[model samples]
Target: MTKAEETRTRIIQQAADLFNQQGYAGASMSDIMAATGLKKGGIYNHFASKDELAIAAFDFALEQVQKRYVRAVKGKRGSIARLKAIIYTFATAPDEVTVKGGCPLLNTAVESDDAHPVLRERAQRGMYQWRRMVHKVVQSGIDSGELQPTVNPDTVATILIATLEGSLMLTQLYGDRIHLQRAEQHLEQYVDSLQHVDNLKQQESSSR
Candidate 1:
């Protein structure tokens, strides 16, 4: 990439980290400039304003999440395994291990929904993508004969997305690990229900 493009990407990455840490309202253009060691005119040359930068930063963050987290479950067998892997990934994310900032989408959703519609639209798109990922997992389970025939992928996916986001919010606000753990517990239960009782024992034993 060109030197200017590389600098722009560095600016976006720094902005995303700050936005995830401080939310849309709290992280200013100056904060981004400070993080990237750029002056006001330099930042404005790449992004028109803080709002525009926020939208791009959020997109960059979500792109990372989709590549790292959502892609893990793609084309995997057994909906239960797919969902479990997803939860496992979130519970053991690279950034989560080193930093305290939780899900970027949730951070933006809570802060931007009523305040910044541009950012909110980006956040909402992210949430829909999240819900779609879960939906695909559930639907695959049914197609593969791992889940009950009557299960609704759309509904189940919606519940999982809402619960996951809410739990993460609480985990951040209360600074407690249990909220995230319990949310994963619920996800586990959902996965368990997808497995056939008759095949579960066989499924459990085959690898061992």
Candidate 2:
């Protein structure tokens, strides 16, 4: 890539980590300048304003998170396996791969709730995308008769997202992985329970 493109990408990468750690409002222009080793004029040369930069950084952070989720479920067949993989991803994310501070969706949602409209909207869209991914997996399970036909994909999605995000918050707050580990165990069991009774019986019979 050209120098200009490379520079812009570097700035976004630095700012994404900074904002994810310090938050949008908490992270001043000087902080970004320090993090990126660029002066005001140099940073502004790429991003028109702090608002613009914040949006770009958030998008970058969200993309990183989305990629993790995609990788978590990659080549995994069946809805239960995919969903469990997602939970495993979240549970192990603190040490595996993450945006430095924490889950961008959770961080942005909490920080931008009443202050930053643009960021709040971005977080909303990101959340929708994540929920939709989970929903599709659950729906596919139902279609394949692996999951109970009566299960609602939307509900399952909400439960998984809420539980995982909430557990992440606790884990971040206390600096302990037990909260996330417990949530992971619970979610795995929950996903297993979604399996169709007939499928469970068939597996039981096959084992005998």
Candidate 3:
């Protein structure tokens, strides 16, 4: 990439990190400048205002999260496996990775819900994307005969997404990992319930 593009990307990366560490209101131009070693003018060359930067940084951070989830489930054959992979990654991934600053979607939702309209919209889009991903997986599971045909994709997706996010929030707030683990356990049970008995038996036996 060109030097200009590299500069823009660097700024975005730094901003994403800072925004994750510090909420939108808590992060500052000076903090970004210090973190990136870019002058105010140089930063302004890439982004106009803190609001713009916040929105971009939020989008950037959220995109990273989406990319991570997608990569985690990529090449996993069944939609149930894919869904399980996602929660497993989130539930059991090393503390160093998922612990810091909590989930980006949850962070943005909490911080920007009332104050920042643009960030709020971006957060909503991120949530919608996640719900849609879950919905797709549930629908595919039904189509592939992996799950019961009577399951409601949209409702199931919404609840799963909400429960995951809520669990993360509580875990982060309480400084306890058990919340995450419990969420994963319950979600796995829910997913297992959707499976046919033979498939479920095979999965359990395979785990043995």
User: Estimated TM-score per prediction?
Assistant: 0.88, 0.98, 0.89
**Per-residue lDDT for 27-103 in model 3, tens only?**
88889899899999999998888888877777777877777788889999987888898888777643536324668
> Local distance difference test, per candidate?
0.79, 0.94, 0.82
Candidate 3's TM-score: 0.89
Please estimate how well model 2 matches the true structure, expressed as its whole-model Cα lDDT.
Answer: 0.94
Candidate 3, poorest ten consecutive residues by summed lDDT:
92-101
Tell me the tens digit of each residue's lDDT in model 1 across 70-123: 567767667787888888777556335322266888787778866788888888
RMSD of 2: 0.9
Instruction: Compare candidates 2 and 3 on TM-score and give the better one.
Output: 2
Model 2: residues >4 Å from true position, as ranges?
none
Which residue pairs collide, candidate 1?
A: none
Q: Which candidate is the best by TM-score?
A: 2
Better of 1 and 3 by lDDT: 3
Model 2 residue-pair collision total: 0
lDDT of 1: 0.79
Worst 10 residues of 1 by lDDT: 91-100
Ranking by lDDT: 2, 3, 1
